[model samples]
Target: MEPDRSTPRTSSRRGFLLTGGALASTLTETSMAQAATRARNTGDADAAPGSPQHPVVTRPADWQPVAERLDGVGRLGTDGLVYRATFPRYDLDLSSYGVSGLVEASYAAFARYPDGRTMLMGDVVATETELQRVTDAVQAHGLEQCAIHKHLLAHRPALWWTHIRGVSTDPVALAVAMRAGLDATATPGPRDPDTAPPAGLDTAAIDAALGAKGVSLDGYRFSFARAETISDDDCVVPPAMGVTTSFTFRSVGHGSAAVSGDFVMTAGEVQQVVKTLRHGGIDVVELHNHALSDNPRLFYLHLWAIGPAVSLARTLRTANAATNLGVVTPDANSSMSTES
Candidate 1:
């Protein structure tokens, strides 16, 4: 399952936004668990992934000052392991038709792996004008762009999404580089925390159609996540932060929704998952990985479509069935903090 390399995602200023961000032709799919299969490149037997695991570090606290430098608060995840910072996209007023900032914000999670190296991974919400600079900054600062593509097919002001990953002993330097790319965009500072949006769509119907649970977010979108337990450098990273199979539904009125989000899959499953999406009338807009060396070598398939909400959900359920996934039920204690 090679990324469509022929479809180059060049950062050469002029062609950064070309497609190949995702690899899908046409297909459709549903279900709970797809068989688990590992993806290995036969030709590249000596490929090197991001980094190796290491012993415990002397500085978990080292990440704090870096968070402050980014002007974002760093939270010690309740898991007491991963350190995370949120950079909300409050700057883009997706509200002409009402898109939630929760849906648009960019964030990165860092973990001091048992292997001693700290790794950072996150996404940035970029506009056409800011895309190139942000891309340049991350690459310049030693961070890698995992994916660059759009979320909404028809959005006002037009926004593009870029997924980034990096590993270093100096977490603050990684944060500094991340901040540099962010400064290129108009993405605003964090706002007073907002409540999950009120729902206008038939929530129960939507959940049933998708075969998974969802949360109401800012009356703008319904979101769900199927998390895969993945790790790097001998440290554990939660599903919500980086590698979750994410789904979002925004009401288009009369029970229809504008659906957008990504599916995390192993290389072997890409074509099948995409085939299922196409069968359901969904568009596979972007197909790429979230990290350079995720243990299983995961790929994220970003999709978009507008239709009867329940019908789209069911098709998503079919596509979900094509991946190796754990059962992702709604958390009764789940809050909107994981909104993105």
Candidate 2:
């Protein structure tokens, strides 16, 4: 996969989780999760404008150690000093209809904060039945469930997607917590890496259209993230957390594709983005907020289209540029990749 330098934008398992807590009876699971988040963030009163400064606690996550903890293989991306583990749901049937490997759960970009603390962020895709239990595990482990929504329209199994976020001086502890959440579902462990099949779409044309880099999945799918570091509650939030404008291209044949995925945007950037999509003859499937109180209040738009891959990529790039990419100053120390 090659990198596309265009202007910007930018899950697993199954297990039964037993949760324990003493609390008032009025709070629902979602509210309780929000409360847990607030309690975790209570210390950030006088935060600075950009990246966070925290006391060094432990070393960053080791490759084999983290892999062993999560029952998967962790690969490091030198581009952003990020290590990620991907757990795919082979149990799902989207592939039966030729959608082909669209259901993947991944935790990416585990890195050390400047102060020596560790931060990690990821997206975990689960179904309706599995969503609550997964969120419970995340909250029980003190990890934050920042956003919850869908990526496709009217797919069977009624899937829902959620973004996971956490920070600690102890990277191992973070992995343990992440593993706890993964265990709450039927998410499987490491598997043999599949060979890349031809994606069939003109990938070079897509790169040119979006002006960003994305990876081709066995010739079935193409995905990219326009990365950005975010700040909301007076702290420098890591970009890998849930702050990317992501696009996924599914090949449908004859140089056309079925476009599905979402864009991460600030509240101020939403309307014009929708306009841009409509201008390109694309349909805005759903527009909604992903998180409750993230620093910049992220809004996501799930979009769909059917056309030449390059044509859709160019249209998506326009919509992507409407977000906070070029408008925001990235953390001075951040090595994030973005174009817009």
Candidate 3:
């Protein structure tokens, strides 16, 4: 063997091929075993700790009883805070609607100077009857009127929005009272299925702009964000008023969409918002304060725009940036300083 060092190894071609094949088969079997083992482990992961199916059970608290009794409409939490419910109504027929009278009364009473002080704040639609009922209700409940306006236009029956507020130790009592006023009106309940979705605008674009993930409601889609801070008589607001800003997009057909949303802003941010919307060709239908004595004060603006939903959303983003509005805490010092 030493003498023949230069000679080639003596394995046949077939033998070489057979050896290579066997090695390859061994590798393949090993790989497959590993893959199957991994699959089994993955399947077993369901029984592992912290798995979704084996979620930890939490003990119920006594407060749950009180919360259930409230029908979840309102709740008093352990933090010593009382939450209130806000109800908004839309109707196509305001004048002949039974609730029209109540709406008008509430507005009128809210507008009267003396009534304004006790009531604190309220809002109304433009229709004469609606305003009258709202004013009257404000007077009756000793609540205040804050603004009168329209949330939408060319809506089937005619639409109006009223913002009302009152302060009471017993928020539930207040809600019950408010319900009585609402019951007096023939405001239609939720829309019927037969009621077709509002026609118009590009549905897909609107969906993309809103980032709405849920199913559409009556062909209209909506997104809502909660106010960053609420105030109580110039201090940190307790969570009593269900204060939230909602953005809604309606399909207007032919790739056109209607964009409208409520923005909750502080005094300092109002001018910037107005300017931004104007620059974007959006209309600021109404800009006014919603609360009278709230600490840091809050203002609500009703905005409208007609365009592609994505474009509208971009404009909204710009407008939102102009104000100290977002999920994160705004520069507190900056926001307060700007308020001056």
Candidate 4:
């Protein structure tokens, strides 16, 4: 008989985990014993594909220690599943095309599994000179770099974005490894949140054009999760872990805005999404994958376009119609389990 699909697997037991080509040196013998106990209890020697496990609902207080470890402030999503910390690249003055309002920031998102493992996923924005050092630091600490590419079309002060991933029973350890990578760059420390939306941009009109509502960050932003189950190493990967389609709009001038974000796509949907965006006159920045062992093999296409805010949103809506995007929810994870 197969192991019960409901049995939760430990973080240290994934046979396909890719952490710089080896398991983190910090995973202890105790973790190994725990994995063995779980396997014995379930009567399964190998991990079996099953329903993606839901992320545990986490409160801000639950992640206070993690924030301390990262030496930055974090905000829990409205859904209470993923806690995210942002490190904007205020140190770098960048520009693409003639648009000077380049949205440059690094982020690390943490999600808790039902089995008590914390998974880390986010991207680091690094200058060309700082890329290798950042990679070396993360690799030395047992974290994995899922993907590396650019988010701008033709930018000065050349930059690279590297997606990082790690899973550990000790969330602080994951924070430490992530911090090591950030330390390699000149990313600034925490600052006040930009509560006000960009001036002269009508977000309501944007919502009407895109057929979805958006929230105000430094600029206006929107996120949509893929309709199908997304799994990595046979474990469910939540939308909050940098897996969703995202768009961030910042006012350029004269009621125009600069939009930058990525669309999460599968192999069959790739060409159509790209063609659709190009047909709408949007600039496709880069195409790549964000995870190594994800089922269905996801693809991420970064995009940039400067136009009237509503027009850009409508063009994005046309591109979105090409994928399997579901309803728009605020930090949505409703299908997954949430703690009371």
**Model 2: per-residue Cα lDDT over 46-84, one tens digit each:** 455443432111122344466667775566543223455
- Which lDDT tens digits does candidate 1 get at residues 1-340? 1111132221211101001111111111121121111111111223344333321212234455666767856565443344567666766666423544325667776655432345566778888888998998877776778777775656667787787766554556667777887888887776654445434678787767766666664333333334445654333445645566767677767887777777878889899999999998998877766665456677777787778878888888888888877766333113232323
Error of 1 at 177 (Å): 2.2
Q: Show the lowest summed lDDT stretch of 10 residues, model 4.
A: 15-24
RMSD of 2: 12.6
Q: What are the lDDT scores of the predictions, listed in order?
A: 0.59, 0.55, 0.40, 0.71
| lDDT for predicted candidate 2 compared with the true structure | 0.55
Residue 262 miss distance in model 3 (angstroms): 2.1
Q: Backbone clashes per model, in order?
A: 24, 29, 45, 0
Local error of candidate 1 at residue 2 (angstroms): 32
What local lDDT score does residue 292 receive in model 1, on the 0 to 100 scale? 53
Q: Show model 3 residue runs off by greater than 4 Å.
A: 1-127, 153-159, 190-215, 218-228, 238-242, 328-340
Model 1: lDDT of residue 168: 57
Compute the lDDT for candidate 1: 0.59
Pick by lDDT: 1 or 3, better one: 1
**RMSD to truth, every model:** 11.6, 12.6, 26.6, 8.9
lDDT winner between 1 and 4, please give it: 4
Q: Give per-residue CA lDDT, model 4, range 1-340, as digits (tens).
A: 1111232444322211112211222222356654453343234223354545555555576777778877856777765567777777777777888867455778888876655567777778899999999999987777778778887788988999888877766677777777888999999887654658788899899999988988776668888888987777645676766678888888887878888888999999999999988987789988888777777689989898888889889899998999999877566322110100
Per lDDT, the best of the predicted structures is 4
TM per prediction: 0.70, 0.70, 0.54, 0.81
